[model samples]
Target: MSNEHITTGQAPKPVGLYPHARRVGNLLFLSGVGPRVAGSGPNDSAVPGLVLDHNGNFKEFDFEAQVHSVFQNVKAILEASGSKWENLVDVTVFLVNMKRDFHTFNRIYAAYFKDNQPCRTTVEVNALPTPIAIELKCIAVIE
Candidate 1:
Protein backbone atom coordinates (compact mmCIF):
# COMPACT_ATOMS: atom_id res chain seq x y z
CA MET A 1 0.00 0.00 0.00
CA SER A 2 0.97 3.66 -0.27
CA ASN A 3 1.60 6.17 2.51
CA GLU A 4 -0.38 9.35 3.02
CA HIS A 5 1.10 12.38 4.74
CA ILE A 6 -1.19 14.33 7.00
CA THR A 7 -1.17 17.95 8.05
CA THR A 8 -3.65 20.22 9.77
CA GLY A 9 -3.95 23.87 10.75
CA GLN A 10 -5.56 22.97 14.04
CA ALA A 11 -2.32 21.71 15.57
CA PRO A 12 1.07 23.27 16.06
CA LYS A 13 3.48 23.04 13.16
CA PRO A 14 6.03 20.31 13.65
CA VAL A 15 9.42 21.37 14.91
CA GLY A 16 11.10 19.81 11.90
CA LEU A 17 10.40 18.96 8.31
CA TYR A 18 7.74 16.33 8.80
CA PRO A 19 4.06 15.99 8.27
CA HIS A 20 1.82 15.75 11.31
CA ALA A 21 1.20 12.10 10.57
CA ARG A 22 1.61 9.35 8.01
CA ARG A 23 -0.85 6.59 7.14
CA VAL A 24 -0.17 3.20 5.65
CA GLY A 25 -3.34 1.29 4.98
CA ASN A 26 -5.54 1.53 8.07
CA LEU A 27 -2.76 2.52 10.43
CA LEU A 28 -2.12 6.17 11.18
CA PHE A 29 1.18 6.99 12.82
CA LEU A 30 1.70 10.46 14.24
CA SER A 31 4.94 12.32 14.55
CA GLY A 32 5.90 13.41 18.04
CA VAL A 33 3.32 16.01 19.02
CA GLY A 34 4.32 18.78 21.36
CA PRO A 35 2.34 21.31 23.42
CA ARG A 36 3.25 24.47 21.54
CA VAL A 37 0.09 26.20 20.34
CA ALA A 38 -1.00 26.03 16.71
CA GLY A 39 0.61 28.53 14.27
CA SER A 40 3.52 28.89 16.67
CA GLY A 41 7.10 28.01 15.90
CA PRO A 42 9.47 25.79 17.91
CA ASN A 43 10.67 28.87 19.73
CA ASP A 44 8.68 31.96 20.63
CA SER A 45 5.99 31.73 23.35
CA ALA A 46 3.85 29.01 21.88
CA VAL A 47 4.02 26.68 24.81
CA PRO A 48 1.13 27.14 27.19
CA GLY A 49 1.83 28.52 30.62
CA LEU A 50 5.53 28.66 30.03
CA VAL A 51 7.85 31.61 29.92
CA LEU A 52 11.52 31.57 29.08
CA ASP A 53 14.12 34.23 29.51
CA HIS A 54 16.56 35.42 26.87
CA ASN A 55 18.84 32.52 27.72
CA GLY A 56 16.05 29.91 27.47
CA ASN A 57 15.81 29.31 31.18
CA PHE A 58 12.38 28.70 32.52
CA LYS A 59 10.91 31.81 34.01
CA GLU A 60 7.60 30.09 34.65
CA PHE A 61 6.50 26.60 33.79
CA ASP A 62 3.30 24.63 34.01
CA PHE A 63 3.41 20.90 33.37
CA GLU A 64 -0.39 20.52 33.44
CA ALA A 65 -0.84 22.90 30.57
CA GLN A 66 1.78 21.17 28.47
CA VAL A 67 0.20 17.77 29.08
CA HIS A 68 -3.25 18.97 28.04
CA SER A 69 -1.95 20.77 24.98
CA VAL A 70 -0.01 17.74 23.81
CA PHE A 71 -3.16 15.65 24.01
CA GLN A 72 -5.06 18.23 21.98
CA ASN A 73 -2.32 18.25 19.37
CA VAL A 74 -2.40 14.46 19.14
CA LYS A 75 -6.14 14.50 18.73
CA ALA A 76 -5.89 17.05 15.95
CA ILE A 77 -3.39 14.93 14.06
CA LEU A 78 -5.54 11.82 14.46
CA GLU A 79 -8.58 13.57 13.07
CA ALA A 80 -6.62 15.01 10.22
CA SER A 81 -5.40 11.51 9.37
CA GLY A 82 -8.98 10.22 8.98
CA SER A 83 -8.91 8.83 12.50
CA LYS A 84 -10.23 9.90 15.85
CA TRP A 85 -9.26 9.80 19.47
CA GLU A 86 -11.22 6.61 20.08
CA ASN A 87 -9.32 4.84 17.31
CA LEU A 88 -6.01 5.15 19.10
CA VAL A 89 -4.33 1.80 19.71
CA ASP A 90 -0.99 2.88 21.06
CA VAL A 91 0.63 5.94 22.63
CA THR A 92 4.23 6.56 23.56
CA VAL A 93 4.80 9.54 25.81
CA PHE A 94 8.03 11.49 26.19
CA LEU A 95 8.53 13.35 29.38
CA VAL A 96 11.48 15.56 30.22
CA ASN A 97 11.16 15.11 33.97
CA MET A 98 9.18 12.12 35.08
CA LYS A 99 9.97 12.63 38.70
CA ARG A 100 8.51 16.11 38.85
CA ASP A 101 5.63 15.61 36.39
CA PHE A 102 4.52 11.97 36.09
CA HIS A 103 1.80 12.18 38.72
CA THR A 104 0.22 15.22 37.13
CA PHE A 105 0.62 13.81 33.67
CA ASN A 106 -0.99 10.53 34.77
CA ARG A 107 -3.98 12.32 36.22
CA ILE A 108 -4.57 14.31 33.05
CA TYR A 109 -3.94 11.29 30.86
CA ALA A 110 -6.51 9.26 32.77
CA ALA A 111 -9.09 11.95 32.31
CA TYR A 112 -8.51 12.02 28.56
CA PHE A 113 -8.11 8.27 27.95
CA LYS A 114 -10.70 7.11 30.45
CA ASP A 115 -12.91 5.68 27.78
CA ASN A 116 -10.57 4.82 24.93
CA GLN A 117 -7.88 3.19 27.00
CA PRO A 118 -5.16 2.51 24.40
CA CYS A 119 -1.90 0.74 25.19
CA ARG A 120 0.53 3.34 26.51
CA THR A 121 4.16 3.65 27.49
CA THR A 122 5.84 6.67 29.01
CA VAL A 123 9.53 7.39 29.30
CA GLU A 124 11.63 10.14 30.78
CA VAL A 125 14.18 11.79 28.53
CA ASN A 126 16.89 14.39 28.96
CA ALA A 127 14.96 16.92 26.92
CA LEU A 128 12.66 17.53 24.04
CA PRO A 129 13.45 19.49 20.90
CA THR A 130 11.52 22.40 22.30
CA PRO A 131 10.88 23.88 25.72
CA ILE A 132 7.72 21.92 26.36
CA ALA A 133 7.68 19.30 29.06
CA ILE A 134 5.73 16.56 27.31
CA GLU A 135 5.27 15.06 23.88
CA LEU A 136 3.23 12.21 22.45
CA LYS A 137 3.71 9.78 19.61
CA CYS A 138 0.52 7.96 18.74
CA ILE A 139 -0.92 5.33 16.44
CA ALA A 140 -4.55 4.97 15.49
CA VAL A 141 -6.76 2.94 13.18
CA ILE A 142 -8.51 4.67 10.32
CA GLU A 143 -11.48 2.41 10.64
Candidate 2:
Protein backbone atom coordinates (compact mmCIF):
# COMPACT_ATOMS: atom_id res chain seq x y z
CA MET A 1 0.00 0.00 0.00
CA SER A 2 1.20 3.45 -0.85
CA ASN A 3 0.64 6.70 0.97
CA GLU A 4 -0.88 9.51 -1.06
CA HIS A 5 -1.96 12.99 -0.10
CA ILE A 6 -5.18 14.16 -1.71
CA THR A 7 -5.84 17.77 -2.57
CA THR A 8 -8.91 19.34 -4.08
CA GLY A 9 -9.72 22.86 -5.19
CA GLN A 10 -13.38 22.38 -4.37
CA ALA A 11 -12.87 22.38 -0.60
CA PRO A 12 -11.36 24.92 1.72
CA LYS A 13 -7.65 24.53 2.13
CA PRO A 14 -6.52 23.51 5.56
CA VAL A 15 -5.09 26.38 7.57
CA GLY A 16 -2.72 25.37 10.29
CA LEU A 17 -1.06 21.98 9.83
CA TYR A 18 -3.01 19.38 7.92
CA PRO A 19 -3.84 18.14 4.47
CA HIS A 20 -7.43 17.93 3.27
CA ALA A 21 -7.21 14.14 3.28
CA ARG A 22 -4.70 11.38 2.80
CA ARG A 23 -4.91 7.93 1.31
CA VAL A 24 -3.04 4.94 2.69
CA GLY A 25 -3.61 1.71 0.87
CA ASN A 26 -7.36 1.57 0.27
CA LEU A 27 -8.33 3.70 3.26
CA LEU A 28 -8.70 7.47 3.31
CA PHE A 29 -8.15 9.62 6.37
CA LEU A 30 -10.04 12.89 6.30
CA SER A 31 -9.22 15.72 8.63
CA GLY A 32 -11.69 17.51 10.83
CA VAL A 33 -13.61 20.07 8.79
CA GLY A 34 -15.34 23.23 9.95
CA PRO A 35 -17.78 25.46 8.07
CA ARG A 36 -15.17 27.40 6.14
CA VAL A 37 -15.28 28.43 2.51
CA ALA A 38 -12.25 28.64 0.27
CA GLY A 39 -10.25 31.88 0.27
CA SER A 40 -12.44 33.10 3.09
CA GLY A 41 -10.25 33.69 6.10
CA PRO A 42 -6.62 34.50 6.70
CA ASN A 43 -6.04 33.38 3.12
CA ASP A 44 -7.24 35.08 -0.02
CA SER A 45 -10.43 37.05 -0.64
CA ALA A 46 -12.60 37.14 2.45
CA VAL A 47 -16.16 35.89 2.29
CA PRO A 48 -18.41 38.46 3.89
CA GLY A 49 -21.19 37.25 6.14
CA LEU A 50 -19.64 33.81 6.11
CA VAL A 51 -18.94 34.14 9.75
CA LEU A 52 -21.87 32.83 11.78
CA ASP A 53 -21.44 35.32 14.59
CA HIS A 54 -19.62 38.54 14.16
CA ASN A 55 -18.84 38.89 17.83
CA GLY A 56 -17.20 35.46 18.20
CA ASN A 57 -20.08 34.32 20.38
CA PHE A 58 -21.47 30.83 20.42
CA LYS A 59 -25.05 31.83 21.17
CA GLU A 60 -25.68 33.02 17.61
CA PHE A 61 -24.43 29.86 15.94
CA ASP A 62 -26.12 28.66 12.77
CA PHE A 63 -26.24 24.94 13.43
CA GLU A 64 -27.99 23.68 10.30
CA ALA A 65 -25.95 25.68 7.82
CA GLN A 66 -22.73 24.77 9.56
CA VAL A 67 -23.60 21.09 9.40
CA HIS A 68 -24.41 21.33 5.70
CA SER A 69 -21.13 23.08 4.95
CA VAL A 70 -19.19 20.44 6.85
CA PHE A 71 -20.75 17.73 4.72
CA GLN A 72 -20.13 19.65 1.56
CA ASN A 73 -16.47 19.92 2.46
CA VAL A 74 -16.40 16.22 3.21
CA LYS A 75 -18.03 15.42 -0.12
CA ALA A 76 -15.49 17.47 -1.99
CA ILE A 77 -12.57 15.71 -0.34
CA LEU A 78 -14.14 12.26 -0.75
CA GLU A 79 -14.85 12.80 -4.43
CA ALA A 80 -11.35 14.13 -4.99
CA SER A 81 -10.04 10.86 -3.62
CA GLY A 82 -12.33 8.83 -5.90
CA SER A 83 -14.61 7.76 -3.08
CA LYS A 84 -18.12 8.54 -1.86
CA TRP A 85 -20.20 8.54 1.29
CA GLU A 86 -21.16 4.91 0.71
CA ASN A 87 -17.54 3.95 1.14
CA LEU A 88 -17.35 5.46 4.58
CA VAL A 89 -16.33 2.98 7.25
CA ASP A 90 -16.17 5.19 10.30
CA VAL A 91 -17.00 8.69 11.48
CA THR A 92 -16.40 10.80 14.55
CA VAL A 93 -18.33 13.96 15.28
CA PHE A 94 -17.43 16.66 17.76
CA LEU A 95 -20.01 19.04 19.12
CA VAL A 96 -19.68 22.01 21.39
CA ASN A 97 -23.29 21.70 22.59
CA MET A 98 -24.29 18.10 22.18
CA LYS A 99 -27.20 18.18 24.62
CA ARG A 100 -28.80 21.21 23.03
CA ASP A 101 -28.54 20.10 19.41
CA PHE A 102 -28.39 16.32 19.31
CA HIS A 103 -31.75 15.94 17.62
CA THR A 104 -31.07 18.52 14.97
CA PHE A 105 -27.65 17.03 14.45
CA ASN A 106 -29.13 13.58 13.94
CA ARG A 107 -31.61 14.85 11.40
CA ILE A 108 -28.93 16.57 9.36
CA TYR A 109 -26.52 13.69 9.71
CA ALA A 110 -29.11 11.17 8.54
CA ALA A 111 -29.57 13.05 5.29
CA TYR A 112 -26.00 12.34 4.26
CA PHE A 113 -25.21 9.01 5.87
CA LYS A 114 -28.60 7.52 5.05
CA ASP A 115 -28.97 3.74 5.56
CA ASN A 116 -25.26 3.16 5.08
CA GLN A 117 -24.45 3.89 8.64
CA PRO A 118 -20.78 3.72 9.40
CA CYS A 119 -19.34 3.09 12.82
CA ARG A 120 -19.53 6.40 14.65
CA THR A 121 -18.66 8.16 17.85
CA THR A 122 -20.04 11.48 18.92
CA VAL A 123 -18.55 13.53 21.71
CA GLU A 124 -19.33 16.79 23.45
CA VAL A 125 -16.52 19.27 23.36
CA ASN A 126 -16.11 22.45 25.33
CA ALA A 127 -15.53 24.64 22.29
CA LEU A 128 -14.49 24.79 18.64
CA PRO A 129 -12.96 27.34 16.31
CA THR A 130 -15.36 30.24 15.61
CA PRO A 131 -17.52 28.72 18.35
CA ILE A 132 -19.37 26.61 15.83
CA ALA A 133 -21.49 23.82 17.23
CA ILE A 134 -20.29 20.89 15.15
CA GLU A 135 -17.23 19.45 13.45
CA LEU A 136 -16.87 16.10 11.65
CA LYS A 137 -14.05 13.84 10.51
CA CYS A 138 -14.32 10.44 8.89
CA ILE A 139 -12.51 7.48 7.41
CA ALA A 140 -13.52 5.58 4.30
CA VAL A 141 -12.32 2.54 2.47
CA ILE A 142 -12.39 2.61 -1.29
CA GLU A 143 -13.50 -0.67 -2.87
Candidate 3:
Protein backbone atom coordinates (compact mmCIF):
# COMPACT_ATOMS: atom_id res chain seq x y z
CA MET A 1 0.00 0.00 0.00
CA SER A 2 1.18 3.51 -0.71
CA ASN A 3 1.80 5.87 2.22
CA GLU A 4 1.11 9.58 2.18
CA HIS A 5 2.62 12.20 4.44
CA ILE A 6 0.13 14.37 6.31
CA THR A 7 0.64 18.02 7.06
CA THR A 8 -1.83 20.49 8.45
CA GLY A 9 -1.61 24.24 8.81
CA GLN A 10 -3.94 23.94 11.76
CA ALA A 11 -1.31 22.23 13.88
CA PRO A 12 1.97 23.59 15.04
CA LYS A 13 4.75 23.64 12.48
CA PRO A 14 7.05 20.76 13.26
CA VAL A 15 10.17 21.51 15.25
CA GLY A 16 12.07 19.16 12.94
CA LEU A 17 11.94 17.55 9.53
CA TYR A 18 8.85 15.40 9.77
CA PRO A 19 5.27 15.51 8.68
CA HIS A 20 2.63 15.71 11.40
CA ALA A 21 1.35 12.29 10.46
CA ARG A 22 1.39 9.63 7.75
CA ARG A 23 -1.39 7.58 6.24
CA VAL A 24 -1.15 4.07 4.92
CA GLY A 25 -4.14 2.01 4.03
CA ASN A 26 -6.78 2.82 6.65
CA LEU A 27 -4.33 3.65 9.40
CA LEU A 28 -2.85 6.97 10.37
CA PHE A 29 0.47 7.12 12.19
CA LEU A 30 0.94 10.32 14.10
CA SER A 31 4.30 11.69 15.00
CA GLY A 32 4.98 12.74 18.59
CA VAL A 33 2.48 15.58 18.89
CA GLY A 34 3.32 18.32 21.33
CA PRO A 35 1.24 21.20 22.65
CA ARG A 36 2.90 23.61 20.34
CA VAL A 37 1.23 26.59 18.76
CA ALA A 38 1.50 27.39 15.06
CA GLY A 39 2.28 30.99 15.95
CA SER A 40 3.61 32.82 18.98
CA GLY A 41 1.76 32.36 22.27
CA PRO A 42 1.64 34.97 24.99
CA ASN A 43 1.11 32.06 27.38
CA ASP A 44 3.99 30.28 25.64
CA SER A 45 2.10 27.03 25.25
CA ALA A 46 4.36 26.01 22.39
CA VAL A 47 5.40 23.60 25.09
CA PRO A 48 2.30 23.77 27.24
CA GLY A 49 2.66 25.00 30.78
CA LEU A 50 6.31 25.37 30.00
CA VAL A 51 7.94 28.72 29.98
CA LEU A 52 11.18 28.33 28.13
CA ASP A 53 13.90 30.89 28.17
CA HIS A 54 15.74 31.80 25.00
CA ASN A 55 18.15 28.96 25.81
CA GLY A 56 15.37 26.33 25.89
CA ASN A 57 15.56 25.87 29.62
CA PHE A 58 12.42 25.62 31.66
CA LYS A 59 11.50 28.74 33.56
CA GLU A 60 8.30 27.30 35.00
CA PHE A 61 6.41 24.02 35.01
CA ASP A 62 2.67 23.51 35.38
CA PHE A 63 2.01 19.81 34.93
CA GLU A 64 -1.77 20.06 35.01
CA ALA A 65 -2.00 22.74 32.36
CA GLN A 66 0.42 20.92 30.12
CA VAL A 67 -1.58 17.71 30.39
CA HIS A 68 -4.83 19.15 29.03
CA SER A 69 -3.08 21.23 26.39
CA VAL A 70 -1.29 18.22 25.01
CA PHE A 71 -4.61 16.44 24.53
CA GLN A 72 -6.06 19.42 22.69
CA ASN A 73 -3.11 19.44 20.31
CA VAL A 74 -3.47 15.73 19.68
CA LYS A 75 -7.15 16.25 18.99
CA ALA A 76 -6.29 18.79 16.32
CA ILE A 77 -3.89 16.38 14.66
CA LEU A 78 -6.48 13.58 14.60
CA GLU A 79 -9.00 15.89 13.01
CA ALA A 80 -6.53 17.12 10.42
CA SER A 81 -5.72 13.52 9.46
CA GLY A 82 -9.37 12.56 9.16
CA SER A 83 -9.16 10.42 12.24
CA LYS A 84 -11.04 10.60 15.52
CA TRP A 85 -9.94 10.29 19.12
CA GLU A 86 -12.21 7.28 19.49
CA ASN A 87 -10.42 5.61 16.60
CA LEU A 88 -7.05 5.68 18.24
CA VAL A 89 -5.66 2.16 18.72
CA ASP A 90 -2.30 2.81 20.27
CA VAL A 91 -0.55 5.59 22.06
CA THR A 92 2.96 6.06 23.38
CA VAL A 93 3.44 8.95 25.76
CA PHE A 94 6.78 10.46 26.72
CA LEU A 95 7.22 12.17 30.04
CA VAL A 96 10.29 13.94 31.27
CA ASN A 97 9.46 13.77 34.98
CA MET A 98 7.43 10.70 35.63
CA LYS A 99 7.95 10.62 39.37
CA ARG A 100 6.96 14.19 39.92
CA ASP A 101 4.01 14.38 37.54
CA PHE A 102 2.77 10.92 36.60
CA HIS A 103 -0.14 10.89 39.02
CA THR A 104 -1.58 14.17 37.82
CA PHE A 105 -0.92 13.39 34.22
CA ASN A 106 -2.63 10.05 34.54
CA ARG A 107 -5.66 11.68 36.13
CA ILE A 108 -5.99 14.23 33.34
CA TYR A 109 -5.43 11.57 30.72
CA ALA A 110 -8.17 9.39 32.12
CA ALA A 111 -10.62 12.25 31.90
CA TYR A 112 -9.77 12.93 28.29
CA PHE A 113 -10.04 9.25 27.38
CA LYS A 114 -13.02 8.40 29.53
CA ASP A 115 -15.24 6.91 26.87
CA ASN A 116 -12.73 5.88 24.21
CA GLN A 117 -9.91 3.85 25.63
CA PRO A 118 -6.83 3.08 23.59
CA CYS A 119 -3.84 0.94 24.52
CA ARG A 120 -1.18 3.22 25.94
CA THR A 121 2.35 3.21 27.29
CA THR A 122 3.87 6.11 29.14
CA VAL A 123 7.64 6.32 29.47
CA GLU A 124 10.02 8.77 31.03
CA VAL A 125 12.81 10.31 29.05
CA ASN A 126 15.52 12.81 29.81
CA ALA A 127 14.20 15.33 27.34
CA LEU A 128 12.29 15.96 24.15
CA PRO A 129 13.37 17.81 21.00
CA THR A 130 11.69 20.87 22.42
CA PRO A 131 11.50 22.14 25.97
CA ILE A 132 8.14 20.44 26.47
CA ALA A 133 7.80 17.77 29.12
CA ILE A 134 5.15 15.68 27.41
CA GLU A 135 4.29 14.39 23.96
CA LEU A 136 2.11 11.70 22.43
CA LYS A 137 2.64 9.48 19.39
CA CYS A 138 -0.42 7.56 18.31
CA ILE A 139 -1.91 5.30 15.71
CA ALA A 140 -5.53 5.53 14.69
CA VAL A 141 -7.76 3.87 12.17
CA ILE A 142 -9.26 6.35 9.76
CA GLU A 143 -12.84 5.32 9.43
- State which candidate has the highest TM-score: 1
Q: By lDDT, who's the top model here?
A: 1
RMSD to the true structure for each prediction, in A, is: 1.0, 2.8, 2.8
Candidate 3 or 2, higher lDDT:
3
| lDDT digits (tens) for residues 1-143 of candidate 2 | 87998877777767667788999999999988766674344353222224534554433446787778878878888998989978989989998888887889899888887778999999999976544567788999877
TM-score-better candidate, 2 vs 3: 3
lDDT of each: 0.89, 0.76, 0.82
TM-score of 3: 0.88
Error of 1 at 98 (Å): 0.7
The C-alpha TM-scores of every prediction are 0.96, 0.84, 0.88
lDDT of 1 by residue, 17-129 (tens): 99999999999999999999977876657899899898889999988988888888888788777889999999999999989999998999899988999999999999888
From the highest TM-score down, the ranking of the candidates is 1, 3, 2
Model 2 residue runs over 4 Å out of place are: 42-54, 58-60
RMSD of 3: 2.8
Residue-level lDDT tens digits of model 3 in 1-143: 85989887777777778888999999999988877765433234466566867876678978887777778777888898889889999999999999998898888888888999999999999988776778889999998
Model 1 alpha-carbon drift over 4 Å, by segment: none
Pairs in clash, predicted candidate 3: none
